[model samples]
Target: MSRPSVWAPKIVALIKGGNSSAAIAQIKVAPTVKDLQDLRKLLIAANLLKPHPNVDAATNDMIAELSAPRLHRSP
Candidate 1:
């Protein structure tokens, strides 16, 4: 993967603060769908996020994606 964006650390901080969705919203640039997905993966790998039972399938997929070794690097 390419070098992480400058916003990566900021996003991680928000996730660690337990406001992941808010972190997503804080992005200034128009990130692609995959970029947001990868941010979730980073949060998961950092053990700062978890799957909520009440969430939809897409969230569950994000949780599951981190359960596996998809990310080449840690957050």
Candidate 2:
């Protein structure tokens, strides 16, 4: 599991810790085109980053636990 202080957990918390309609109706939660493009670019760059062998093993173990029914689905 990811540490509570980590970015992954923070992203999950931000997206899940709210009511959908209430959040959309009462708060400005839209991402602008530029904002989305920037995020996409960042994700692409991150995906292209080299994976260390040790990190890959650890990530594989974590993903196996998370996707028990489809271990090969993830990259």
Candidate 3:
């Protein structure tokens, strides 16, 4: 199994400390989709964020955009 990210502890600390705005700012620049997904799970688990269809749709869209193959033109 892979080790948890370093950011996980920091973000969780933020959540626990009621520093959601800082946590959200960190989340916005999460380096990977996995990070974003993990943070979302954390937020939901902490009851700081509620599940919603729009949020789900936005997550799916972000995943799609980030994972989609990029087209490269031959030089």
Among these predicted structures, which one has the highest TM-score? 3
Report, for every candidate in turn, its global Cα lDDT versus the true structure: 0.54, 0.34, 0.64
* Estimated TM-score for each candidate: 0.43, 0.26, 0.55
Q: For model 3, state the Cα shift of residue 75 in Å.
A: 9.3
TM-score of structure candidate 1: 0.43
1 or 3, which is superior by TM-score? Answer: 3
Model 3, residue 74: C-alpha shift (Å): 13
Residue 72, candidate 3: Cα error in Å is 9.3
**Per-residue accuracy of model 2 over 1-75 as CA lDDT, tens digit each:** 843223333322333454333322222332233333333244345552133233223333444444446546656
Ranking by lDDT: 3, 1, 2
Cα error, residue 13 of model 1, in Å, equals: 0.7
Off-target runs (Cα >4 Å) in candidate 2 are 1-6, 9-44, 47-51, 69-75
Going through the candidates in order, what is the number of backbone clashes in each? 0, 0, 0
Over 4-54, each residue of candidate 1 has an lDDT whose tens digit, in order, gives: 665556677765666746654454342444555665567567765544222
State model 2's lDDT: 0.34
In angstroms, how far off is 52's CA in candidate 1?
7.5
Clashing pairs in 2: none
